[model samples]
Target: MATTTASVMGPHQKYAFEDTTSLLKDINRLPLFMTELDPTDGEGGSNLALEALQALAYEGTPFEIASNFKQQGNDCFSLKHFKDAAEYYGRAIAAILQNDKKKEETSGENSTDKAELAETDEHGSPLQIIDNCGPNADDDEAEKLKELVTTCYLNRAACNLELKNHRRVINDCAEVLKVQPRNAKAYYRSARACLAIDKIKEAQECVERGLDLEPQNSYFKNLAIKIMQREDYLLKVQQQNTQREFMRKHVVRI
Candidate 1:
Protein backbone atom coordinates (compact mmCIF):
# COMPACT_ATOMS: atom_id res chain seq x y z
CA MET A 1 0.00 0.00 0.00
CA ALA A 2 1.27 3.47 -0.95
CA THR A 3 1.06 6.24 1.70
CA THR A 4 0.52 9.82 0.60
CA THR A 5 1.67 12.90 2.58
CA ALA A 6 -0.73 15.74 3.29
CA SER A 7 -0.03 18.97 1.44
CA VAL A 8 0.65 21.79 3.93
CA MET A 9 -0.14 25.38 2.97
CA GLY A 10 2.86 27.75 3.02
CA PRO A 11 2.55 31.46 3.95
CA HIS A 12 2.25 32.57 0.33
CA GLN A 13 -0.31 29.83 -0.41
CA LYS A 14 -2.44 30.65 2.67
CA TYR A 15 -4.21 33.53 0.94
CA ALA A 16 -5.08 34.46 -2.61
CA PHE A 17 -2.36 36.63 -4.27
CA GLU A 18 -4.71 39.65 -4.62
CA ASP A 19 -6.21 39.17 -1.09
CA THR A 20 -2.72 39.33 0.53
CA THR A 21 -2.50 43.07 -0.16
CA SER A 22 -5.98 43.59 1.37
CA LEU A 23 -4.89 41.56 4.47
CA LEU A 24 -1.83 43.78 4.82
CA LYS A 25 -4.08 46.84 4.66
CA ASP A 26 -6.24 45.34 7.45
CA ILE A 27 -3.11 44.73 9.52
CA ASN A 28 -2.10 48.37 9.06
CA ARG A 29 -5.51 49.43 10.43
CA LEU A 30 -4.91 47.51 13.71
CA PRO A 31 -3.52 50.62 15.42
CA LEU A 32 -6.86 52.35 14.91
CA PHE A 33 -8.46 49.87 17.33
CA MET A 34 -6.86 51.63 20.29
CA THR A 35 -8.11 55.05 19.27
CA GLU A 36 -11.67 56.17 19.97
CA LEU A 37 -13.46 55.54 16.73
CA ASP A 38 -16.32 57.82 15.62
CA PRO A 39 -19.71 56.14 15.71
CA THR A 40 -20.77 57.90 12.52
CA ASP A 41 -17.69 56.59 10.76
CA GLY A 42 -17.84 53.39 8.69
CA GLU A 43 -15.87 51.49 11.38
CA GLY A 44 -18.05 48.93 13.22
CA GLY A 45 -16.01 48.91 16.50
CA SER A 46 -16.62 51.36 19.32
CA ASN A 47 -14.26 52.74 22.01
CA LEU A 48 -15.00 49.57 23.97
CA ALA A 49 -11.69 48.13 22.78
CA LEU A 50 -9.75 50.99 24.34
CA GLU A 51 -11.85 50.80 27.49
CA ALA A 52 -11.27 47.06 27.73
CA LEU A 53 -7.54 47.56 27.33
CA GLN A 54 -7.54 50.15 30.10
CA ALA A 55 -9.55 47.86 32.38
CA LEU A 56 -7.22 44.97 31.63
CA ALA A 57 -4.25 47.12 32.57
CA TYR A 58 -5.83 47.83 35.97
CA GLU A 59 -7.02 44.27 36.66
CA GLY A 60 -4.74 42.43 39.09
CA THR A 61 -4.48 40.77 42.50
CA PRO A 62 -4.93 43.11 45.46
CA PHE A 63 -1.22 43.29 46.18
CA GLU A 64 -0.44 43.93 42.52
CA ILE A 65 -3.04 46.70 42.27
CA ALA A 66 -1.72 48.28 45.47
CA SER A 67 1.82 48.07 44.15
CA ASN A 68 0.80 49.73 40.88
CA PHE A 69 -0.92 52.56 42.71
CA LYS A 70 2.10 52.90 45.00
CA GLN A 71 4.37 53.28 41.98
CA GLN A 72 2.03 55.92 40.58
CA GLY A 73 2.15 57.73 43.94
CA ASN A 74 5.94 57.61 43.91
CA ASP A 75 6.00 59.10 40.40
CA CYS A 76 3.65 61.92 41.43
CA PHE A 77 5.74 62.56 44.57
CA SER A 78 8.89 62.76 42.45
CA LEU A 79 7.14 65.43 40.38
CA LYS A 80 6.18 67.24 43.62
CA HIS A 81 2.45 66.78 43.04
CA PHE A 82 1.87 66.14 46.74
CA LYS A 83 -1.94 66.24 46.66
CA ASP A 84 -2.17 63.77 43.79
CA ALA A 85 0.51 61.59 45.36
CA ALA A 86 -1.45 61.39 48.61
CA GLU A 87 -4.55 60.43 46.67
CA TYR A 88 -2.72 57.57 44.97
CA TYR A 89 -1.25 56.38 48.27
CA GLY A 90 -4.73 56.44 49.77
CA ARG A 91 -6.00 54.27 46.93
CA ALA A 92 -3.16 51.81 47.56
CA ILE A 93 -4.07 51.64 51.25
CA ALA A 94 -7.73 51.05 50.45
CA ALA A 95 -6.86 48.22 48.07
CA ILE A 96 -4.71 46.48 50.67
CA LEU A 97 -7.33 46.88 53.40
CA GLN A 98 -10.00 45.43 51.14
CA ASN A 99 -7.81 42.37 50.59
CA ASP A 100 -7.20 42.07 54.31
CA LYS A 101 -10.93 42.10 54.98
CA LYS A 102 -11.50 39.36 52.42
CA LYS A 103 -8.76 37.26 53.95
CA GLU A 104 -10.25 37.72 57.40
CA GLU A 105 -13.67 36.65 56.18
CA THR A 106 -12.26 33.58 54.50
CA SER A 107 -10.29 32.69 57.58
CA GLY A 108 -13.39 33.01 59.71
CA GLU A 109 -15.20 30.59 57.45
CA ASN A 110 -12.40 27.99 57.56
CA SER A 111 -11.51 28.37 61.23
CA THR A 112 -12.06 25.58 63.77
CA ASP A 113 -11.50 25.12 67.48
CA LYS A 114 -8.03 23.68 67.38
CA ALA A 115 -7.41 24.22 71.11
CA GLU A 116 -7.44 21.15 73.32
CA LEU A 117 -7.61 20.69 77.08
CA ALA A 118 -4.27 21.11 78.73
CA GLU A 119 -2.60 18.00 80.15
CA THR A 120 -1.12 17.82 83.63
CA ASP A 121 2.40 16.67 84.48
CA GLU A 122 3.27 13.98 87.07
CA HIS A 123 3.17 16.61 89.85
CA GLY A 124 -0.32 17.80 88.70
CA SER A 125 1.03 21.05 87.18
CA PRO A 126 -0.05 22.05 83.67
CA LEU A 127 2.57 21.18 81.11
CA GLN A 128 4.02 23.99 79.04
CA ILE A 129 2.97 23.47 75.46
CA ILE A 130 5.13 25.19 72.88
CA ASP A 131 3.49 25.61 69.51
CA ASN A 132 5.94 24.57 66.79
CA CYS A 133 3.66 25.70 63.97
CA GLY A 134 5.97 28.23 62.41
CA PRO A 135 4.94 30.94 59.96
CA ASN A 136 2.77 29.48 57.24
CA ALA A 137 2.21 30.68 53.70
CA ASP A 138 -0.74 32.82 54.75
CA ASP A 139 1.30 34.39 57.53
CA ASP A 140 4.03 35.23 55.03
CA GLU A 141 1.55 36.86 52.65
CA ALA A 142 -0.08 38.79 55.50
CA GLU A 143 3.33 40.05 56.62
CA LYS A 144 4.12 41.23 53.08
CA LEU A 145 0.78 43.06 52.79
CA LYS A 146 1.28 44.61 56.22
CA GLU A 147 4.67 45.92 55.15
CA LEU A 148 3.16 47.33 51.96
CA VAL A 149 0.40 49.08 53.90
CA THR A 150 2.98 50.54 56.29
CA THR A 151 4.97 51.85 53.33
CA CYS A 152 1.84 53.40 51.82
CA TYR A 153 1.05 55.14 55.11
CA LEU A 154 4.61 56.44 55.34
CA ASN A 155 4.52 57.74 51.77
CA ARG A 156 1.15 59.40 52.35
CA ALA A 157 2.58 61.03 55.45
CA ALA A 158 5.42 62.42 53.37
CA CYS A 159 2.96 63.81 50.83
CA ASN A 160 0.84 65.34 53.59
CA LEU A 161 3.96 66.90 55.07
CA GLU A 162 4.66 68.66 51.77
CA LEU A 163 1.02 69.78 51.58
CA LYS A 164 1.18 71.12 55.14
CA ASN A 165 -1.54 68.78 56.33
CA HIS A 166 0.00 68.42 59.77
CA ARG A 167 -2.80 66.39 61.35
CA ARG A 168 -3.04 64.06 58.38
CA VAL A 169 0.72 63.54 58.44
CA ILE A 170 0.57 62.69 62.12
CA ASN A 171 -2.31 60.24 61.59
CA ASP A 172 -0.55 58.42 58.76
CA CYS A 173 2.65 58.17 60.72
CA ALA A 174 0.68 56.88 63.71
CA GLU A 175 -0.75 54.12 61.51
CA VAL A 176 2.77 53.14 60.48
CA LEU A 177 3.97 53.14 64.07
CA LYS A 178 1.03 50.95 65.15
CA VAL A 179 2.10 48.32 62.65
CA GLN A 180 5.86 48.83 63.00
CA PRO A 181 6.69 50.23 66.40
CA ARG A 182 10.39 50.46 65.62
CA ASN A 183 9.89 52.51 62.43
CA ALA A 184 12.17 55.52 62.80
CA LYS A 185 10.80 57.43 59.81
CA ALA A 186 7.24 57.26 61.16
CA TYR A 187 8.36 58.67 64.50
CA TYR A 188 10.38 61.37 62.78
CA ARG A 189 7.50 62.42 60.54
CA SER A 190 5.03 62.36 63.42
CA ALA A 191 7.37 64.47 65.51
CA ARG A 192 7.75 66.98 62.71
CA ALA A 193 3.99 67.28 62.25
CA CYS A 194 3.37 67.62 65.98
CA LEU A 195 6.04 70.28 66.21
CA ALA A 196 4.47 72.11 63.26
CA ILE A 197 1.17 72.25 65.15
CA ASP A 198 2.91 73.21 68.44
CA LYS A 199 2.02 69.96 70.14
CA ILE A 200 5.19 70.15 72.13
CA LYS A 201 4.58 67.18 74.41
CA GLU A 202 3.54 64.91 71.57
CA ALA A 203 6.45 66.05 69.46
CA GLN A 204 8.85 65.46 72.31
CA GLU A 205 7.54 61.94 72.83
CA CYS A 206 7.86 61.10 69.12
CA VAL A 207 11.37 62.56 69.01
CA GLU A 208 12.39 60.53 72.05
CA ARG A 209 11.03 57.35 70.47
CA GLY A 210 12.70 58.03 67.14
CA LEU A 211 15.98 58.84 68.81
CA ASP A 212 15.75 55.61 70.76
CA LEU A 213 15.36 53.76 67.46
CA GLU A 214 17.95 55.79 65.56
CA PRO A 215 20.25 57.56 67.99
CA GLN A 216 22.64 58.71 65.28
CA ASN A 217 20.01 60.06 62.86
CA SER A 218 20.64 63.75 62.13
CA TYR A 219 16.97 64.44 61.39
CA PHE A 220 15.82 63.05 64.73
CA LYS A 221 18.62 64.86 66.54
CA ASN A 222 17.69 68.17 64.95
CA LEU A 223 13.98 67.64 65.60
CA ALA A 224 14.71 66.86 69.24
CA ILE A 225 16.56 70.18 69.59
CA LYS A 226 13.69 72.06 67.96
CA ILE A 227 11.19 70.41 70.29
CA MET A 228 13.27 71.35 73.31
CA GLN A 229 13.56 74.94 72.07
CA ARG A 230 9.82 75.19 71.49
CA GLU A 231 9.10 73.80 74.95
CA ASP A 232 11.42 76.35 76.56
CA TYR A 233 9.85 79.22 74.60
CA LEU A 234 6.36 78.12 75.61
CA LEU A 235 7.46 77.82 79.22
CA LYS A 236 8.85 81.39 79.15
CA VAL A 237 5.63 82.74 77.62
CA GLN A 238 3.57 80.98 80.34
CA GLN A 239 5.77 82.42 83.06
CA GLN A 240 5.48 85.95 81.60
CA ASN A 241 1.71 85.61 81.50
CA THR A 242 1.67 84.44 85.10
CA GLN A 243 3.79 87.43 86.18
CA ARG A 244 1.52 89.84 84.36
CA GLU A 245 -1.52 88.26 86.04
CA PHE A 246 0.09 88.61 89.50
CA MET A 247 1.01 92.24 88.89
CA ARG A 248 -2.54 93.03 87.69
CA LYS A 249 -4.05 91.34 90.76
CA HIS A 250 -1.69 93.22 93.20
CA VAL A 251 -1.84 96.63 91.44
CA VAL A 252 -2.53 99.53 93.90
CA ARG A 253 -5.75 101.48 93.28
CA ILE A 254 -5.16 104.97 91.87
Candidate 2:
Protein backbone atom coordinates (compact mmCIF):
# COMPACT_ATOMS: atom_id res chain seq x y z
CA MET A 1 0.00 0.00 0.00
CA ALA A 2 2.76 2.42 0.90
CA THR A 3 4.58 1.70 -2.33
CA THR A 4 1.45 2.27 -4.47
CA THR A 5 0.56 5.33 -2.47
CA ALA A 6 4.04 6.76 -2.85
CA SER A 7 3.94 6.24 -6.62
CA VAL A 8 0.52 7.84 -7.07
CA MET A 9 1.46 10.85 -4.95
CA GLY A 10 4.87 11.28 -6.56
CA PRO A 11 3.48 10.84 -10.08
CA HIS A 12 6.02 12.26 -12.59
CA GLN A 13 8.84 11.89 -10.08
CA LYS A 14 7.65 8.61 -8.62
CA TYR A 15 10.04 5.86 -7.56
CA ALA A 16 8.93 2.54 -6.19
CA PHE A 17 10.36 -0.83 -5.19
CA GLU A 18 8.94 -4.34 -5.10
CA ASP A 19 10.02 -7.50 -3.39
CA THR A 20 11.14 -9.88 -6.13
CA THR A 21 10.81 -12.98 -3.99
CA SER A 22 7.20 -12.23 -3.18
CA LEU A 23 6.45 -11.35 -6.81
CA LEU A 24 7.96 -14.62 -8.05
CA LYS A 25 5.95 -16.56 -5.46
CA ASP A 26 2.61 -15.27 -6.81
CA ILE A 27 3.27 -16.03 -10.49
CA ASN A 28 2.80 -19.81 -10.60
CA ARG A 29 0.21 -19.99 -13.41
CA LEU A 30 0.85 -20.35 -17.15
CA PRO A 31 -1.71 -17.71 -18.24
CA LEU A 32 -0.08 -15.22 -15.88
CA PHE A 33 3.29 -16.28 -17.32
CA MET A 34 2.21 -15.15 -20.79
CA THR A 35 1.21 -11.79 -19.41
CA GLU A 36 4.58 -11.53 -17.68
CA LEU A 37 6.40 -12.43 -20.90
CA ASP A 38 4.49 -9.71 -22.76
CA PRO A 39 6.23 -6.88 -20.91
CA THR A 40 9.62 -8.60 -21.33
CA ASP A 41 9.11 -9.05 -25.08
CA GLY A 42 8.58 -5.36 -25.78
CA GLU A 43 11.27 -4.69 -28.40
CA GLY A 44 11.85 -1.01 -27.81
CA GLY A 45 12.86 0.58 -24.56
CA SER A 46 13.77 -0.97 -21.18
CA ASN A 47 11.80 -4.23 -20.85
CA LEU A 48 10.69 -6.70 -18.20
CA ALA A 49 13.68 -9.08 -18.30
CA LEU A 50 16.17 -6.32 -17.55
CA GLU A 51 13.96 -4.75 -14.90
CA ALA A 52 13.11 -8.07 -13.22
CA LEU A 53 16.74 -9.18 -13.20
CA GLN A 54 17.82 -5.85 -11.72
CA ALA A 55 15.33 -6.41 -8.93
CA LEU A 56 16.58 -9.92 -8.21
CA ALA A 57 20.29 -9.52 -8.90
CA TYR A 58 22.89 -9.25 -6.19
CA GLU A 59 23.05 -5.60 -5.22
CA GLY A 60 26.01 -4.04 -3.42
CA THR A 61 24.37 -3.22 -0.15
CA PRO A 62 27.12 -2.31 2.36
CA PHE A 63 25.25 -2.50 5.65
CA GLU A 64 23.69 -5.82 4.81
CA ILE A 65 27.22 -7.03 4.06
CA ALA A 66 28.69 -5.64 7.25
CA SER A 67 25.99 -6.95 9.55
CA ASN A 68 26.94 -10.45 8.52
CA PHE A 69 30.69 -10.33 9.31
CA LYS A 70 32.42 -13.52 10.45
CA GLN A 71 35.66 -14.61 12.06
CA GLN A 72 37.88 -17.19 10.34
CA GLY A 73 37.66 -19.72 13.17
CA ASN A 74 34.01 -20.12 14.09
CA ASP A 75 31.90 -22.96 12.69
CA CYS A 76 28.45 -22.52 14.19
CA PHE A 77 26.90 -19.14 13.43
CA SER A 78 23.99 -17.16 12.07
CA LEU A 79 23.81 -14.94 8.98
CA LYS A 80 20.53 -13.21 8.35
CA HIS A 81 20.53 -10.57 5.66
CA PHE A 82 18.31 -7.71 6.67
CA LYS A 83 15.48 -6.48 4.45
CA ASP A 84 16.55 -4.13 1.68
CA ALA A 85 15.21 -1.09 3.49
CA ALA A 86 16.80 -2.03 6.79
CA GLU A 87 20.07 -2.97 5.14
CA TYR A 88 20.22 0.39 3.36
CA TYR A 89 19.63 2.14 6.64
CA GLY A 90 22.42 0.13 8.27
CA ARG A 91 24.75 0.94 5.35
CA ALA A 92 24.36 4.66 5.90
CA ILE A 93 25.53 4.36 9.49
CA ALA A 94 28.31 1.98 8.50
CA ALA A 95 29.93 4.08 5.75
CA ILE A 96 30.47 7.36 7.60
CA LEU A 97 31.74 5.86 10.83
CA GLN A 98 33.88 3.36 8.99
CA ASN A 99 36.04 6.12 7.54
CA ASP A 100 36.37 7.91 10.84
CA LYS A 101 37.59 4.80 12.61
CA LYS A 102 40.12 4.11 9.90
CA LYS A 103 41.64 7.58 10.11
CA GLU A 104 41.65 7.43 13.91
CA GLU A 105 43.38 4.09 13.96
CA THR A 106 45.85 5.20 11.32
CA SER A 107 46.94 8.23 13.34
CA GLY A 108 46.76 6.36 16.66
CA GLU A 109 43.70 8.40 17.55
CA ASN A 110 41.23 6.62 19.79
CA SER A 111 37.54 7.53 19.88
CA THR A 112 34.23 6.03 21.00
CA ASP A 113 34.14 3.46 18.23
CA LYS A 114 31.53 0.77 18.69
CA ALA A 115 30.47 1.17 15.11
CA GLU A 116 34.10 0.74 14.13
CA LEU A 117 34.33 -2.57 15.92
CA ALA A 118 31.20 -3.87 14.24
CA GLU A 119 32.15 -2.32 10.93
CA THR A 120 35.70 -3.66 10.80
CA ASP A 121 34.73 -6.52 8.58
CA GLU A 122 37.24 -9.37 8.85
CA HIS A 123 35.24 -11.53 6.43
CA GLY A 124 31.81 -10.96 4.97
CA SER A 125 29.19 -13.75 4.78
CA PRO A 126 27.47 -12.80 1.52
CA LEU A 127 30.69 -13.52 -0.35
CA GLN A 128 31.10 -17.07 0.99
CA ILE A 129 27.89 -18.99 1.64
CA ILE A 130 26.41 -20.70 -1.45
CA ASP A 131 23.20 -20.32 0.50
CA ASN A 132 22.49 -18.68 3.83
CA CYS A 133 22.54 -22.12 5.42
CA GLY A 134 25.85 -23.86 6.16
CA PRO A 135 26.42 -27.60 6.38
CA ASN A 136 28.51 -27.80 9.55
CA ALA A 137 27.16 -24.45 10.69
CA ASP A 138 23.75 -25.99 11.33
CA ASP A 139 25.06 -27.93 14.29
CA ASP A 140 28.50 -26.57 15.07
CA GLU A 141 29.25 -22.94 15.99
CA ALA A 142 33.01 -23.12 15.33
CA GLU A 143 32.61 -23.97 11.65
CA LYS A 144 30.41 -20.95 11.11
CA LEU A 145 33.30 -18.57 11.86
CA LYS A 146 35.48 -20.20 9.24
CA GLU A 147 32.64 -20.00 6.75
CA LEU A 148 32.30 -16.31 7.47
CA VAL A 149 36.01 -15.84 6.97
CA THR A 150 35.78 -17.76 3.72
CA THR A 151 33.07 -15.38 2.62
CA CYS A 152 35.27 -12.35 3.32
CA TYR A 153 37.99 -13.82 1.14
CA LEU A 154 35.39 -14.23 -1.60
CA ASN A 155 34.21 -10.64 -1.36
CA ARG A 156 37.74 -9.26 -1.59
CA ALA A 157 38.57 -11.68 -4.37
CA ALA A 158 35.57 -10.35 -6.29
CA CYS A 159 36.55 -6.76 -5.68
CA ASN A 160 40.04 -7.57 -6.86
CA LEU A 161 38.66 -9.26 -9.95
CA GLU A 162 36.66 -6.12 -10.75
CA LEU A 163 39.91 -4.12 -10.64
CA LYS A 164 41.56 -6.60 -13.05
CA ASN A 165 43.61 -8.07 -10.24
CA HIS A 166 43.86 -11.58 -11.65
CA ARG A 167 46.68 -12.64 -9.34
CA ARG A 168 44.60 -11.73 -6.33
CA VAL A 169 41.62 -13.41 -7.90
CA ILE A 170 43.71 -16.58 -8.12
CA ASN A 171 44.67 -16.12 -4.49
CA ASP A 172 41.03 -15.81 -3.48
CA CYS A 173 40.11 -18.85 -5.55
CA ALA A 174 42.83 -20.77 -3.78
CA GLU A 175 41.47 -19.65 -0.42
CA VAL A 176 38.00 -20.81 -1.36
CA LEU A 177 39.34 -24.13 -2.63
CA LYS A 178 41.09 -24.63 0.69
CA VAL A 179 37.73 -24.49 2.41
CA GLN A 180 35.40 -25.79 -0.28
CA PRO A 181 37.42 -28.04 -2.57
CA ARG A 182 34.43 -28.84 -4.75
CA ASN A 183 33.63 -25.22 -5.63
CA ALA A 184 33.30 -25.43 -9.41
CA LYS A 185 32.68 -21.74 -9.91
CA ALA A 186 35.73 -20.82 -7.89
CA TYR A 187 37.88 -23.13 -9.97
CA TYR A 188 36.41 -21.71 -13.15
CA ARG A 189 36.85 -18.15 -11.98
CA SER A 190 40.43 -18.90 -10.98
CA ALA A 191 41.16 -20.41 -14.35
CA ARG A 192 39.83 -17.29 -16.03
CA ALA A 193 42.07 -15.12 -13.90
CA CYS A 194 45.03 -17.35 -14.57
CA LEU A 195 44.49 -17.11 -18.30
CA ALA A 196 44.31 -13.33 -18.06
CA ILE A 197 47.59 -13.27 -16.14
CA ASP A 198 49.28 -15.51 -18.76
CA LYS A 199 49.54 -18.44 -16.38
CA ILE A 200 48.66 -21.13 -18.89
CA LYS A 201 49.69 -24.18 -16.88
CA GLU A 202 47.86 -22.98 -13.78
CA ALA A 203 44.83 -22.09 -15.83
CA GLN A 204 44.83 -25.55 -17.44
CA GLU A 205 45.05 -27.21 -14.06
CA CYS A 206 42.18 -25.19 -12.66
CA VAL A 207 39.95 -25.80 -15.66
CA GLU A 208 40.79 -29.51 -15.68
CA ARG A 209 39.97 -29.62 -11.96
CA GLY A 210 36.60 -28.00 -12.62
CA LEU A 211 35.92 -30.45 -15.46
CA ASP A 212 36.82 -33.32 -13.19
CA LEU A 213 34.31 -32.06 -10.69
CA GLU A 214 31.52 -31.69 -13.28
CA PRO A 215 32.33 -33.76 -16.36
CA GLN A 216 28.95 -33.21 -18.02
CA ASN A 217 28.81 -29.42 -17.56
CA SER A 218 28.60 -27.63 -20.88
CA TYR A 219 29.82 -24.35 -19.45
CA PHE A 220 32.90 -25.96 -17.94
CA LYS A 221 33.61 -27.72 -21.20
CA ASN A 222 33.35 -24.41 -23.02
CA LEU A 223 35.75 -22.83 -20.57
CA ALA A 224 38.20 -25.68 -21.14
CA ILE A 225 37.94 -25.19 -24.90
CA LYS A 226 38.67 -21.51 -24.57
CA ILE A 227 41.72 -22.21 -22.42
CA MET A 228 43.06 -24.82 -24.79
CA GLN A 229 42.66 -22.48 -27.78
CA ARG A 230 44.41 -19.63 -25.97
CA GLU A 231 47.31 -21.78 -24.80
CA ASP A 232 47.72 -23.36 -28.23
CA TYR A 233 47.71 -19.95 -29.87
CA LEU A 234 50.37 -18.70 -27.46
CA LEU A 235 52.54 -21.75 -28.15
CA LYS A 236 52.15 -21.29 -31.89
CA VAL A 237 53.09 -17.62 -31.68
CA GLN A 238 56.17 -18.44 -29.59
CA GLN A 239 57.30 -21.09 -32.06
CA GLN A 240 56.77 -18.75 -34.99
CA ASN A 241 58.81 -16.04 -33.28
CA THR A 242 61.62 -18.45 -32.48
CA GLN A 243 61.75 -19.77 -36.06
CA ARG A 244 61.69 -16.26 -37.49
CA GLU A 245 64.54 -15.15 -35.23
CA PHE A 246 66.63 -18.25 -36.09
CA MET A 247 66.07 -17.86 -39.83
CA ARG A 248 66.97 -14.16 -39.74
CA LYS A 249 70.24 -14.88 -37.85
CA HIS A 250 71.33 -17.84 -40.06
CA VAL A 251 70.16 -16.65 -43.52
CA VAL A 252 72.46 -17.99 -46.31
CA ARG A 253 73.90 -15.59 -48.92
CA ILE A 254 72.07 -15.86 -52.24
Across 36-55, the per-residue lDDT of candidate 2 in tens digits comes to 33333333554555446423
Query: Which tens-of-lDDT digit does each residue in 1-254 have in candidate 1?
Result: 99999998766653456476555644444435412223321256544544454345346766787788889799889989898778777776665444422244233221011001111122111111111112343656666677776788789899989899999888777666765789999999999999999999899999898888888999989888888998999899999999999999999979
Quantify all predictions' global Cα lDDT against the true fold. Answer: 0.67, 0.52
Candidate 2 scores a C-alpha RMSD against the true structure in Å of 14.8
- After superposition, the stretches of candidate 1 with alpha carbons farther than 4 Å from their true spots are 1-58, 100-137
| Candidate 2, lDDT over the whole model | 0.52
Candidate 2 stretches greater than 4 Å from native: 1-139
Per-candidate TM-scores read: 0.63, 0.48
RMSD of each: 15.1, 14.8
The per-prediction tally of clashing pairs is 0, 14
Worst 10 residues of 1 by lDDT: 110-119
Worst 10 residues of 2 by lDDT: 71-80
